[model samples]
Target: MADGKNWRRAGYVGAGAAGLLAGNLALVTGSIVRAAGRTPAAVDDGPDPLLIDPPQLMRSTVAPTGDGTLLHVETSLDLDEHPSDTVLVLVHGWTCSTRFWNPQVNQLAQHWPVIAYDHRGHGLSEMGEKKVSVAMLGQDLEAVLTSTLPAGKRAVLVGHSMGGMAIMSWAAQFGANMADRVAAVVLTSTTARDVVQQQLLTPPTLPRYTEMVKPLVARAFVAAPVPLPSNELTSRLTHYMALGRHARAAHVEFTDELISRGSPRSRAAWGAAMYRLDVAAGLHALSVPTSVVVGSDDLLTPPLHADYMAQVLDHNGVLRDYVTYGGAGHMVPIERSEPYNVLLDDVLKAA
Candidate 1:
């Protein structure tokens, strides 16, 4: 009788404790969900970048860059119902290729035609002269769009990092002409003005020593036209920065292969242009509905930078929706693919 009574007492205490714990968890989760709203963290370790499930129409070809250079480009068609009146053209960042957009291609293509191409010297594209500029990249995009999709059809332009700057450059040069055709713009982990000046004005993510190395790398790339050690070195070093953990081994391997494919000329050109890039005018002039996505933990382009962009647009009477994801670093497209695709769809649907 005594043992039975004690057992019942112990069970009651355990149940009470469990209930309290559960209640606390519920409270915290609710707080998080409320604060974060629609944007949620991506919590999965899935297929590696290289092994990204293939899209329905994966086409590859070399297109004219309008510079007399045959630049390589790739496009992925939707596997599901294709929505006309919209095509999503993805522009990748520094040292990254069209494959970087793989995670979102199929998902976004479901609603629209998704096309991405390697910048002149990145991915499968032809190598060009060193000392690249955002203007040059913008020209490449124009050539690709005019030759392949052109401006006649309505399109949504999505760009990340250097790709973002390239699109802005295109807009700056082309202005309302391009804006009329472009229904929306998605800028991720990128900047609108002189990055060097901005970095100096704000909290520095990469060490000052790292900035010092930029000019050196650019010169070496332009002069020698040989792939620099820094490209591979940085790739190996920052492989795990995208997500909190090292991406699946396949992701690392695929990223390595893609970056390795970039020509020294392209790399150097991009580096030089990056140092001098300033698209504040373009960003302010963008009349299309815009979405700016950044990772809360992004060191390269921190949340503050995204905030600045929003402020810029707001002041210009151009309102842009900003989505900041927690626990994600610079490589957002690959690390948090689903969230990106979902948000992009929402933006597209609204457009």
Candidate 2:
């Protein structure tokens, strides 16, 4: 009885200590990133489209996930001027909302009908009772597709980070019916599996421990559940970790704004999902013409991940292209928007 009590006490103490350490680690890493990473480009005085005048989209409608939870889905279509036959369904990564695709949406909406949705816990979406997992992301995506996609019209799915995972998950789960709706796929700065093992967000030594790092420190980093600080230091850190060398000051601030809005509960929930992510089957299941884009210096999901995914996508003659932007980081979609737009143009043309 005494031993059980002592063990329980120790567990409590250990958890508290871990939480404190994770908090401190975040600050330390942020400082390091600010110090060592490239300086942001000059800020233009003009109002940034993302922050000041974000393009107004269609009504915010609710879409039910596979489990019956509602997800916030919005669309932008300029059918009167530039009518396009195909659709673009954009999904964002962990800790981000539909606004993450604002850049692409603004540019592409002029020609293509664009649909973007928030994950269950991000933005205005309702979190279902089920525990969060990569599989659940795929399920949510399916719900969005079923709800918004017009019957008999196919759409191209574009996902970034966890968004990419959702696409892969969908392909794996519903590959047999994929052709019915999915016209093509675009995976940007994402991985198939073993993200913790392959990621460089934390130091190298942390993951070497067979027992601790993968299961503890790295996961703890994502699952910290602490509110994101919106200070200049935190913005710089976010820029360093998520953006590439070419990122501008506005980019950093924009990214920080979106990240800061992420609720603690949602961050913790999705962090765990991403930490233990494995979607190799989904990668293999993708039957549509697909392109994998990676920033050469991405720390979250590095080029190595893109390499493996490109290889998997190539297996069934489905790989249309593989691109590595030289000075970009994890957010290749924003960091290289023009090039990304061109890539989309190619995909839509081919589709």
Instruction: Output the number of the TM-score-best candidate.
Output: 2
The predictions' CA RMSDs to the true structure, in order, are 18.3, 4.5
Estimate the overall C-alpha local distance difference test score of candidate 1.
0.67
110-152 per-residue lDDT for model 2 (tens digits): 6787788999999999877899998888888888888888766
Worst 10 residues of 1 by lDDT: 197-206
Model 2 clash pairs are none
Q: Candidate 1, residues 91-117: lDDT per residue as tens digits?
A: 998878877887787576555776788
Give the clash count for each candidate. 3, 0
TM-score of each: 0.73, 0.85
